[model samples]
Target: MINENVSIALVHYPAMDKEGKLIVTSFTTMDLHDIARPARAYEVRSFYIVQPIDAQRLVIKRQIDYWLSEEGRAANPTRYEIVQLVRLKYTLEEVVEDIERERGKKPILVGTDARKYHKTIGYAELKREIEDREREFLIVFGTGYGLPPDLMRTFEYILEPVYGAGDWNHLSVRNAVAIILDRLFSKNRC
Candidate 1:
């Protein structure tokens, strides 16, 4: 079980801006310390190229190993268990395969009105259901433009599309995460 003291984290290779430049030399702590020195906005932002799978695997291995360390293990044993870990690599479609294989049931994928369904799924009700039926629930998502059509069809419900900011979508995943974390902490009276 996870402790109240620790939290889960995920890292991604954020796509580069329209500019061809990937890496900037100004991410050093000293650089941020001297913001008055006048640096381009991009200079403060570090960038990475599309990483290779082997490189990604190496990164995951190193990360999991670090998590398995004494302090880390206490933080999240399930995430970094020394015992067998059921990690399977597959494209978005394989989410169905893995769910059926392990749970003998397919996951409910939702699309369309993402916001409406997200809110409709009462968090408290979900908690009660999970408490009674099972403690674990798996949610999978598609990346890179549109979601997989086959998987989208399998969703039990479609979420309403959300509109925010301006004509174009402006919110980043980090922003969404911060908002969610804030809600969680608020709920826990933290």
Candidate 2:
């Protein structure tokens, strides 16, 4: 399973504000649902929501618990299935550790941002690498403005920005995840 070796992390902490200062952004209910839906649809191994704040983490946990409960499942079984793939974590390091523990090796960290880096792997090349399944891959997305430059530099591959016909490149992390997942995992690609 190509996608089984792939995972995603939505980092709320270590994110940049519009001014580019590092900050911990709050997670929204929409992010959980939107990202998890595509992740489950793509058969991603797991969806990680990384937040350092305890209160925020608690709120997210409650939502996850409710969606996975019998009543919640009865209300929306499809949502329950998507919520099952979500894993809450305090930091990105924990996400990596979790994957390392599960796979017995570290996953190749693939970062996504609106800005282009000096060296970025194209979607086609990454898709081929993912198809080969030589190792696990975890594509990381950031909330707020974006991930900090120092953090972005640490990733093994920062995927090329998803461009549009216009010059504006800003995209919601949820939308970015959906687009990147489609580009990498969709069977029918142009």
Candidate 3:
């Protein structure tokens, strides 16, 4: 399954602030819930949340623990199932290492941003490559002002920025995940 070969990472560190300075952004509970729902729906193999801060990672771990508990399952079985897709990592390198361990091959790194990069690949072209290739893909998303240029350069391909009708390009990482997953995996896409 194509979806099974795809994974996503919501990166909070090495991101840019509004002024374009690199910073670590905090993750919200909503980000976990909203993004996981779509990822599970698409049957993505895994969803990694990358945060360098130990404190933030603990908070996320606690939440995940609850969601996986019997009480949490009783409270919301659907969410319990979805939450299982999430994996916490202290760095993007950790994410790559984990994926490589699980799949026995390094995933093709794809970055996401509101601004286009020189290596930007269109959705259609990316979809074709994903279908044609045998390797797994990890689509990395940045929070705050988006990923820093140095980090962006590490990716093999940066997906074309998602554009609406207007010039405003800012999109919540959760919303972008949902939209990108739909674009890449939806069975009824037009």
Candidate No. with top lDDT: 2
TM-score of each: 0.41, 0.98, 0.97
lDDT of 1 by residue, 60-89 (tens): 445545665777677866434421232323
Q: For residues 1-190, what per-residue lDDT tens digits would candidate 2 score against the true structure?
A: 3488899999998999999998999989999999999999888999999999999999999999999999999999999999999999998999999999999889999999999997699999998998888899999999999999999999999999998899898999989999999998887877
- The best candidate by TM-score is 2
**lDDT, candidate 3, 1-190, per-residue tens:** 3477789999999889989998999989999999999999888889999999999999999999999999999999999999999999999999999989988989999999999899999999998888875888999999999999998998999999988899787889988999998898789997
Per-model RMSD to reference = 12.0, 0.9, 1.0
lDDT: which is higher, 1 or 3?
3
What TM-score should be assigned to candidate 3?
0.97
Candidate 2, residue 89: how far the Cα is off, in Å:
0.3
Q: What's the C-alpha lDDT at position 130 in model 2?
A: 86
Model-by-model lDDT, in order? Answer: 0.33, 0.93, 0.92
